[model samples]
Target: MAVAPSFKLPNVGPGPDPLSLSALAADNEFVLLLLQRDYHCGNCRKQVQVFADWYDEFHERNTEVVSIVPEPRERVRSWQEEYDLPYPLCADPEAAAGEEYDQPVRFGPLGRFSDLLGRMPKAVLLDCRDGDPTICYTHEGSSTWDRPELEEVFDAIDEQR
Candidate 1:
C-alpha cells in the first residue's frame, strides 16, 4: 500500500515555496523513504547505504529515489556526503511527511511508554504518473533490513514501468 499526501514545504537550494508534488511526479516516478536519527544503531547507516545503492541503479532507468531524514540541513548534508549518496536527501526535522504517510511514527515500545512516540523509521514508495500519485509500498518497524520483501519492492517499481 502507498500513501499519497499533499504537502507545501520549502524546497532545497532555493527554488520555490509550496513545492508541487504533481510537478515532481510528472518529471519522474519516485520512491521516498523516511528515516529517523538512530544514534544507537549503526544499522540505520547501512540502511541508507542500501537505499543509495538502489538509487544509483534506479536512476539509470529514470526512476527517482529520494530519502528524507528528520534532521537539520547540516546534519543531513553531512550524512549524505559521508554516504556518498547521489540523490537528494531532504531535511524533515518535524517528521511531517512521516505522519502524512500514516507510518507508526509512534506506538512502539519506547514510544508508547514515553514522550518519543512520534519518531520512527519508515519507507513509502510513490508511483508518480500523469495522474495523481499513488503509494506503491510501505514498511515500518525494526526489521527493515530484511530481504525478499525489499526485493519485492524493487520488483513492484520495475513492474510499474
Candidate 2:
C-alpha cells in the first residue's frame, strides 16, 4: 500500500474550508492538479491556460482539473480573472499539498535548477475506491505542457474505460 504523504494546510476557497486530498478524491473524479510556484510568471500563466483547454476536453469524461498555486487568495482571484480559467484556482502558500505530492513549488528560467525549485511539475491521476484513493499515473518534468508521458496517460485512462 502506497501511502500519500501527509499534508495539512489551510484551504483558501469560497465554499469548503480546509479541503483534504481524501475528500477531494471521494467522488471517483480524476483530479488533475497543476502546481505552480509563482502567479506572475508568463510561463505559469500559459500553462494554466493550456490546462483550462485540456479540462474542457476532460470534463466530458467526468474529470476535474484544478490549478494549485503558492500565492495569496487575492492574487489567485486576479489570476482567475485575468486568464479566465474555467476550473477552480486555489492557493497553497504554505505548499502543504505540493509537499505531499513532492511537486515543485517554484519556477525560473534556469529550469529545474531554479533556486525556488521545490517540487517537480507533475500530473497525478488518482482513482477513488470506497472513499480511499489509488494513484493511477504520474508525470513529472521540467515543463508540464510538453511532457511526452501525457499521451500515454490519456491512452491508459481510455483503456480503463
Candidate 3:
C-alpha cells in the first residue's frame, strides 16, 4: 500500500477547525478522504450527503470522513451551509492537495483551466492506526458519476482490521 498524501487545510467544519491529515490519523483508525470534482458537481454533492447520513456508522467503526473540494474557502463554506456535513469539509483552491493524491484531470488544457470541466472524483480510504497513514483502499473514478459503494469501503476497513 502507498502512504497517503498529507494535507493541512482550512476546515469548514462541524469537526476540526484546521483539518490536518496527520492529526486526523492520530485520532482515528481510518480516515476516508473524498476528493471531489468541484463545488458544482451534482454527484459530488449527493455523495457527500450520503456520507453525512452514514457518518454515525463510520464513527462507530472508528473512521473519519473528510471531504476535500478543490475550490476556495468561501466556496467550500457554501457547501457547509447547504449540507451541514457531520465531518470535515476542507478547501483546496490551488488543487495542491488534490494533486498530491493524484486526483484525475482530463480534457487537456480545459481541465487545468477549469476543474469543473475536467476533474473527476476520487475516494481514498487510509489506514491510520499506525503513525503514518497508509492507503488501504482507493476508487479513482473514470467518469463524474463513478464512485465506490459504501459497502466496498466498509469491507476494506473490516479486512484491514
Candidate 4:
C-alpha cells in the first residue's frame, strides 16, 4: 500500500488558503485528491463540477474533495470564478505535489516540458484517521478522460469503513 505524500499549496476556492495534506487528513475521515491534467482540461472541469454537485453526499460520508491544478495561482483562481466549487481548489504551479504522487506524464521529455501535452488525470483517496495519511485507493489515468466515477470512490471508502 502506498502512503500519501504530504503537501501544502495555495487554495483558490471556497475554502482555506494554503491548505495542507496533514490538516485535511486531520479534519476528515477521507480526502479525495483530484489531480488535473492542466488548466484548460474540459474533462477536469467536468469532473470537478460533478464532485461539486455531489459535494453534500461526500461530506455526509466524512470525505472532503480537493482538486489540484498544476498551474499558477492566478490560473487556478480563474477556475474559482468560473466553477465556484464548494471544495478546496489548490494551485500547484510547479507540479511538485503531482510529482510527489506520481501523476502520470507521457511523451517523455516533451510531456515533462508541457503538462497539456503529457499529463494525465489521477484520483487518490486517502484514509486520514490514522496518524499517517495512507492511500486507500488510487485511479491513475492512462488518458485524460480516464477517471473513476464518484460512486466508485464512495464504494472504496465504504469498503474501508
RMSD of each: 3.8, 4.1, 0.9, 0.8
CA lDDT, every model vs. true structure: 0.59, 0.60, 0.92, 0.93
Report the error of model 2 at residue 4, Å: 4.0
Instruction: Indicate which candidate wins on TM-score.
Output: 4
Candidate 3 off by > 4 Å: none
Whichever of 1 and 4 has more lDDT, that candidate is: 4
Off by over 4 Å in 2: 1-18, 104-119, 143-153
Residue 102 miss distance in model 4 (angstroms): 0.5
Return the candidate ranking by lDDT, descending: 4, 3, 2, 1
lDDT of 1 by residue, 1-161 (tens): 44488664433422233345565677776645544443223555677677667765677556665565655566666776677766556666665666676655455677534324445566676777745788876667644343224576677678777
Q: For residues 1-161, could you state the per-residue lDDT of candidate 4 as single tens digits? A: 67899999999986668999988988999999999999999999999999999999999999999999999999999999998999999999999999999999999999999999999999999998886899999999999889999889999989988
Model 1: CA > 4 A from native = 1-3, 8-20, 37-41, 106-118, 142-150
Q: Determine the backbone clash count of candidate 2.
A: 3
Model 1: lDDT equals: 0.59
Residue-pair clashes per candidate: 1, 3, 0, 0
